[model samples]
Target: MTEGMGDKTEGAERILCDEGLRVAVGGLGDRVVVDVRDGTANRFWTDTSNLEKALHGEAVRIDAHGGYCVIEVREGTGRLDLVMEGVEHKHCDFSTGDLADAIAMVREQSDPEGSLVERA
Candidate 1:
């Protein structure tokens, strides 16, 4: 979705208004990848297949601050759900914080116990 990423990066978009803080939702091969850009320009990537299934254009409750966010697929019509920490929920437009959290959740699921991070 960036200037040169192309369709290979479906569902990938920038979120959060803060400079250097953004996320890309897309896939490589058969795996979905969410790339997070922090304030320091450090990049963190996560795969969010589970989060994508929650449907888009609908309200999703995010755990952080009970914020409302919406999940939308890039270049597609699919939506998503945000079931955040502590079982809180938010429904609204796609956002940087929600995408960041989704990436974190996926990373946690993929690398429970820190094995993946250590191996990488």
Candidate 2:
């Protein structure tokens, strides 16, 4: 399980894993942004609406890298679980508040319009 770290943005907290993955959590409109990254690539698996559903105890699946990824937010805790199944299986857990600030950084560094589509 990942622990919450110091604040990384105005309303978000960030967590850095030793494997070089990062997660940031923050609000986006009425939904939450669970932004995950490996190096510079965003490996997010769900859209804002689906993320909201996950936060409400739903399991959401998305096609990814020729297979599929399952995303879910633990009930009442807001922790995110991402499980990728392809040639190999991978799992990541992001504590609540570890997926927000990166959205701001991504917005500022990339084209806002493109980021919108990327995050969607």
Candidate 3:
């Protein structure tokens, strides 16, 4: 729902944000893709159909290319629970009040050096 992404329709992909970082969402069936590009050749992404369900505290985890990301709703507060394996063996945890904050958290971690600012 970020600015310029427009209203989401059934099965439509949208680029949520593409500033110092790029985040896009799309897919269908039991799949929802959240692709994050930190302005590097390497990218970090996740796809899961359980996101909506997970917002009720049902934790979901996905592993990819020697790393992993987890998403769930925080108990009690119902906040978004996002945990990911970051660069150089870093384990990052983000408890965001909403999806936008979650995306921002990812952008900050994925591009900690602000390398994408110039390209953006």
Candidate 4:
């Protein structure tokens, strides 16, 4: 779990699997694992360390049903071997400021806008 995780109620914990993949622990229950992406069923573990280097503000591919949701690591325990979320592209250098702002922007963009469709 990420640092200072257990302090918050109904909060998320940074979880690093033994295989080395990182995922935010949204919540835990019997036969139910909540992550940054809602309602994930297919879970996999890999020994790949590529995701461990992932840091706050870095993006990741959250595997779910049918498709995947691209998200950023909002927080993590800064460690060399810490397993973190895996994503496609990473440009920011794990800076705190960049991470925070980028995540905020992402959340804003994720909000639903009804049946409204965008053209071009």
Candidate 5:
């Protein structure tokens, strides 16, 4: 092995997204997981440390989905913000058993259909 060379991974990480939309969470640690085909306008502002890191440090961040909607959870923030950029943004205090809502969101967005979804 050459000096300063990292071991190359033969294949990218494969994710079993819900629905029919397949996606992967590359090098970024649960930071920006977007629909590659639909992420042309994607961008985000997150703390240097990622979600897990933020949680560990008790910090929060604001991010948009589809580069359009804002569906996110942050540390020390007792609210959920849903924003449809250039259209609307909503915010409300966290709700009961919200862990369910979160899981449901993941399932719907991950692979709402039954088909082959590739990693980008």
Candidate 6:
């Protein structure tokens, strides 16, 4: 959390590194927001949820050459399997589907006998 912003924020933390990058992470009610800014013109903001479940120590790696990225939530005890961790899968699966369809996907995954649709 930033110095003066602490009282106004919840689950917030600000990291200042020797590399001169400033990062802010926090939550507002039900959403998590992250901001990254350098002294230059590279400031950016990324907001999402399920953050509290992925804080303290989580990992996000992008494998450009390998063609895939991995994002995992890590707790003090261990890493969490997102499906079982109860994190909402995706807002649209592609972010353009019907809201009901998205919810149905989550509901389908909740079943013990349901088969997952894997990318081919």
Winner by lDDT: 2
All candidates in order of lDDT, best leading: 2, 3, 1, 5, 4, 6
Q: Which residue window of length 10 is worst by lDDT in model 1?
A: 1-10
Clashing pairs in 5: 18-110, 18-111, 19-111, 19-112, 19-113, 20-111, 20-112, 20-113, 65-69
State the lDDT of candidate 5 residue by residue for 4-101, as single tens digits: 11122122232323222232222222123322112232333332234233323333444444333223345544333333446344444432234333
Ranking the candidates on TM-score from highest down gives: 2, 3, 1, 6, 5, 4
Better of 1 and 6 by lDDT: 1
- Candidate 4 on 68-89: residue-level lDDT in tens? 3333455543222222245332
Can you list the residue pairs that collide in candidate 4? 22-84
Which pairs clash in model 2?
23-98, 24-98, 24-99, 24-100, 25-98, 25-99, 25-100, 26-100
- Tens-digit lDDT track for model 2 on 12-109? 33453334345554433332334455443334434445654554577766543434445565743444334444223445665433333333432334
- lDDT of all predictions, in order shown? 0.36, 0.42, 0.40, 0.29, 0.31, 0.27
Point out where model 1 deviates above 4 Å.
1-20, 41-48, 56-119
TM-score for candidate 6, residues paired by index: 0.28
Deviation (Å) of 45 in candidate 3: 7.6
CA shift at 2, candidate 2, in angstroms?
26
Write the number of the candidate with greater TM-score, choosing between 1 and 3.
3
Candidate 2 residues lying further than 4 Å off, grouped into runs, are 1-46, 75-86, 99-120
Q: What tens-digit string does per-residue lDDT give for candidate 1 at 29-113?
A: 2234333333322222322443444334333322222222234545433333333345444323345355555454443443333
Candidate 5 minimal-lDDT segment of 10 residues: 1-10
lDDT tens digits by residue: candidate 6, 66-92: 122223433333221211122232210
Residue 118 deviation, candidate 5, in Å?
Answer: 23
